[model samples]
Target: MRLLIVDDQPLVRQGLRAVFAGLDDIIVAGEAAHGAEALELVRRTAPHVVLMDVNMPVMGGLEATRRICAAGRADPDRTLPKIVMLTMYDQDEHVFEALRAGASGFLIKDASPQQLADAVREVVDDGAMLSPSITRRLIREFVRRPALPAPDGELSALTGRERDVFRLLVQGYGNAGIAEKLTLGESTVKSHVQSLYRKLGVQDRVQVVIYAYENGLI
Candidate 1:
């Protein structure tokens, strides 16, 4: 996997590069000092994943993310690199904004090298990286907001089995875990998940989680 490291701090960029250097499967595509540089490198290197710091001069990670995501959406041929935001602050506002800006994952800046490597791999495998702490904070942040009524018959298209799968998924169950709980095969659970994604117009499990929260289904 090709990885891009983006940060204003040279030390941070160097450190991240070094971490990926040890992993034979991961290649350090490039490094950028700020968001603008990151954008240029992204177009040049076409990395599969980007490790981006939130705050920077010229352009911030959030804005760059928005632009990159938009460009990817507009051009069907260009592969959109998954962006994993690196931030010091674990504030709810920051987390929410990153999601809104199209970040595939969020990671604390202080994360260990292994955790960082794992996060990149997970996002590449159609997964998202939200640490347990971040997940809890996100839940609490949404819980404090005024509840939104789910659209009428929003779930009517889903079958009873699909609903069961969605419920477990929103509660943080993976396909294997959901299968175990539902007494079904892993492949069957995967089918239900894909069906849920199709009916809900969501791209991945992370989007499904956000959808459930936005519609107050959680």
Candidate 2:
């Protein structure tokens, strides 16, 4: 997997590059000090995924993500590069907005080298990835929210089986896990996932969960 590291700090960028250096399946394609430079490098390097810092000078990751994803949506034939926001602890509160801004997922800034490599591969293979703590935290937050009227149009749009799939999916199960739980084939699970995205007009599993929570479907 080719990667573009975007951060304002030189040492942080160096640390990330060094982590990938020993990995046989990973390559550090380029580096940028901030989101603006990352945007330019993204077009030139065409890295499969970008590890973008949430905060940077010139342009932050959120704005860069919006612009990049907006352009990608305009041309369906071209694949937009996946972005995973690299966030610090204080930035956890901004993760939801980052997803809305078009990040595929995010990781904590203090992630270990192996965790970093795994996150890159996970997003590429699964379409999204969240740190375990983030997953638990999101679920807890969703559970604690007071009930709201479910979005009938969105909820009713789903078939019974699709709702079954969505239930497990929002609980943080991936394709394999969902398939096993439903006793369905992996391709069948993938089809349901695609259907969920299409019907809900959501980009990733994270948004699916958010939708479920906000709509009181969780």
Highest lDDT, which number? Answer: 1
Candidate 2 lDDT by residue in tens digits, 119-207: 89988775587788887776677788897898788778989989999899878788999999999999999998878777887767767
Model 1 CA lDDT for position 133: 84
Cα deviation in Å at residue 190, candidate 1? 4.8
lDDT score of residue 53 within candidate 1: 89
lDDT of 1 by residue, 93-200 (tens): 778988877787999988999999999999887689987788899878888877789865759999999999989988878888899999999999888987877688
| Residue-level lDDT for 71 in candidate 2 | 73
> lDDT, candidate 2, residue 169?
86
Worst 10 residues of 2 by lDDT: 89-98
TM-score of each candidate structure, all chains considered together? 0.84, 0.87
Measured by TM-score, how close is model 2 to the native structure?
0.87
